[model samples]
Target: MPTPGSTQRKFRLADDALWAEYDQACRDINGSTDRSDDIRKHVEAVVAEWKQRHKMN
Candidate 1:
């Protein structure tokens, strides 16, 4: 079995992956068109959601 610290690290990595995916999606969407205020707001929302999930603040 994994140690408690390792379990926490795994959870953190999963959260990081979620953020990375969101960033990649933002880049992909931005690449297909011009950056708009709505897109920026969407990215901010995604980041906020990730931070909340990870208890980062």
Candidate 2:
């Protein structure tokens, strides 16, 4: 659903809560850009950190 003359892409998540969690982490990491997401490695790492914070063990 790209708009004309726009380079942005869109994504859909199954839940808003998951997106909220990722958004918080993204801010902490200064966010992915220039293709730095690299297979979502950074996202996964931050999610691990969030789990640790919540004592999700």
Candidate 3:
């Protein structure tokens, strides 16, 4: 998966309510408490789809 040596990243939410909503959505889709890997996978999927649709490499 991704060569196994990826750099960690940090992101800030708009506010506490937004952060809570995002966290709950992740948890709901994951069906478990742990979201460490799910978040990355979801973000990657979103970025890939966006780039493909926009013809951006």
Lowest summed lDDT window (length 10), candidate 3: 1-10
The TM-score of candidate 1 is: 0.36
| Residue 40 displacement in candidate 3 (angstroms) | 1.2
Query: In model 1, where is the ten-residue run with the lowest total lDDT?
Result: 5-14
Per-residue C-alpha lDDT of model 3 across residues 1-57, encoded as one tens digit per residue: 344788767666669987677678878987764556777788999999999989964
Compute the lDDT for candidate 2.
0.65
Per-residue alpha-carbon lDDT of model 2 for 1-57, expressed as tens digits? 446997874456789887766667666666543333543576889898999989965
Query: Which candidate do you rate higher for lDDT, 1 or 2?
Result: 2
Superposed by TM-score, candidate 1 places the C-alpha of residue 53 at a distance from the truth, in angstroms, of 0.1
Best by lDDT: 3
Q: Which 10-residue span in candidate 2 carries the lowest summed lDDT? A: 31-40
Colliding residue pairs in candidate 2: none
Q: How do all the candidates rank in terms of TM-score, highest first?
A: 3, 2, 1
CA RMSD, predictions in order: 12.6, 10.5, 4.7
List the candidate numbers ranked by lDDT, top first.
3, 2, 1
